[model samples]
Target: MTKLRQFSRNLAKNGLLFNLFILSNLILSGCTSSTQPTYPKESIDQAIQDICKKEYKTDVKVKLVGSTLWIYLPIPEGIVEKSNKPEKFIERFVIEQNNNELKDEIVSVNYLIKPVPEQEKLQDMKYSKAAFDRINNVWKVLRRVIFSMEHPEQNSPKFFVTVTADTKNGFLIKEIFYYPDFKKVSYELMSWGEYQHRAIQETEVSPKIIGDTQGLNLKYSDISFEDFILQQIQHRIRLKFQKPEAEKNADIDKEILKIIRYTLKAYGFKDFSTLELNNLATVRKITLNQTAVFSGSGD
Candidate 1:
């Protein structure tokens, strides 16, 4: 009876161990689902976004060969011109995949070159190439991204830059843009920050100006310094965004008027007697013909 009990006990122990092993295997397999996140698409898209933030001194040369793209951007030396003191020239390379295939769809866009300036002596240049790269280098990249986002349908692949070795330690990049159907798009320098600051400024008194003075005929002497600072900052921010006159051509005066009126209303003005924007180019003035009336939900 004792021997039979021992055999049964050993068999029960083996059976429990076997059950635990099977349970662990089942749990691990359950974790392996097809819905889990993976790379390839997301990672590549992030890489492209990063490329748009880099700066090149002279120009970046890009070429598409089958699945791979080549990028050659220059790295400028601190060799500034005899007179020009603030800028150094450098180049950078970036690549984007054109074909949809993932097989061998690798991009090689990591090269730099330096462009020499047209000066006999590289003496008076004080700032280094790193300094120029720090300041104005990313502007071109930002412009390209803006252009791509703005004119997606109209832009074609032929619109790119090509770089090659020139004599005398210099290089040249031929700007080109090609379509998938082989149509060519002429290269043009994109205008960046063209509409950056274009708005009208409005002036208004703050509620703090009439804080405890309860009367329709409040004095301007009651206005506080805090109110003054707030108004000044608001005015400056508006002026900083004011559009250039040339951009306002083509009789869009109605649109401009609407914007100005909306801005005034937002700044807590009720009824204005008159509002006139002066096109007097010599003065650059905004003359109000009359004062504003009031009465609204404010206490």
Candidate 2:
């Protein structure tokens, strides 16, 4: 039998408030990638470095370790701010429903609302000009480089996008994401709201030399790809409760169930017997078995 879904309970404090956060994950897939690209892995760094320096006038550090591509960019100073980010566009809701015991209960749900660029304030956008440009540059450079290789994968299955936010304090903003998720929105394979829901971020205060060659001062965290995905889902959920927007009047239960359903199905994770969700605010806990989670599977 494979490993089971494990749970570790802890209380998180935010200013004057402390909410019990439930953080647990079940990874059903293998830790390693099934297929590594055919590209010459050694030349990857050189190609990215040359492109960054010559084309963007910015020196970038890139490494393709296993299936994940790690890129660090020292974008223009204001790309990342030194303050807390606004958590808008994520809606939460609750509704009444009856369970199998013939009793009425409340179900909670949260959704990542779509961004209306026209009506959205500058603060609402995910990236500042410099941040967006630098990330786009990385994507562009990778595509150019991969085009020269035989049978390019066209995208990185997993990637780490790290940017230097504050030089004085050595603040770094790191986001781990699945590259093709952007395409999913375009292809209508997933909703724009679903795409926006991704969240595996590390706004670390790691001290490091600024403008140094290849981010030599930065250290690579030895984290597994599956762990990253779990963290992504956990953080995304945490944000919904942390800094929420207007509460929508929908079935929060179904909303959350849909989120979990999409994520689990996408990754082929089905080994878990039960999923646990706890609310420290109310001292309430709900455990849903695999049958309830994937309710349609029996049919």
Candidate 3:
């Protein structure tokens, strides 16, 4: 009887060990299967292309670059030929991965609309070197004058504007505004294209203002000053370019200079010299010669 009891106890212990081992194996198998994601790349690509075609009414090139998917929509020649309004067609493209049941698989999606290239006949038109040079000179003058007015105490505020030709468009202008300590205050991009000459955008980095007044009176408060100057510059350029063929390309420098001076006067600064393309660097020293003459209130 004692031998039989010992045998039964041994059998029960072995059976328990075997059951525990099997349970552990099943648990590990389940974890491994769940951790692996099953995402069909081809299916996702096809889905995106189909959606884009339906939305834009045009075909798009879909490319998966690493974790990000880039959808390139070339501006359809038919659309451009039929419609002259580019802004109307420039709709913001948003792709919701969760709605498409791809939130767990795809990392990011990008929509890139290619710029409309000038027609072959239009491309044959020779770019005006003289016009480009004049525009560039005026831009430099504007930059120098604005820098001087903004930082009267600092000498040679390191301001620069670069104008370059765009292959598809016309001209690209990049302007940089710098601080007295030689750091960048703001950067702006303006495009002088065949269709439009306008301010594209401006980006600025917030500067750490060191002063006793803590919360309200910060340097960021005067951030709009740069934007105001840029807007005036763009406005003058746009007026020059957007005029009728007979009035277009009329002496831009004189008009731009007059506008700048009038704007400065309105803002209570009269000592600023009229910006001349040749004498841009000469106006490094600026003085506030008057107080607020116009209250900017309409009668």
How would you encode candidate 3's per-residue C-alpha lDDT over 171-234 as one tens digit per residue? 2222222232111211212111311222222211222211211212111212233344445444
Predicted structure with the largest TM-score when compared to the true one: 2
The C-alpha TM-scores of every prediction are 0.19, 0.59, 0.21
Instruction: Give the per-residue lDDT digits (tens) of candidate 2, residues 1-299.
Output: 00000000011001101100100010111122224344565577677788878998767877776666677776535344322564223223221221121112212222333222222211221334565566656655655464444444543435545444444435555656565653343234665445445535545554464444456776666445455555655555444433342244433344445556666666665655666543433444566767776664411
Per residue, candidate 1 scores C-alpha lDDT tens digits across 167-241 of: 112321211212221111112121112111211112122233222212222221222222322333232222222
lDDT of each: 0.27, 0.46, 0.28
Instruction: TM-score for candidate 1, please give it.
Output: 0.19
Q: Which candidate ranks first by lDDT, i.e. highest?
A: 2
Task: Please tell me which model should have the higher TM-score, number 2 or number 3.
Answer: 2
Question: lDDT score of model 2?
Answer: 0.46
Candidate 3 stretches with Cα past 4 Å from truth are 1-227, 242-246, 270-274, 279-299
- In terms of lDDT, the poorest run of 10 residues in model 2 is 1-10
Task: Give the per-residue Cα lDDT of candidate 3 at 10.
Answer: 25
What value does the lDDT take at residue 54 in candidate 2? 95
The segments of candidate 1 whose C-alpha lies over 4 angstroms from its true place after superposition are 1-132, 149-196, 199-259, 262-299
> What's model 3's TM-score?
0.21
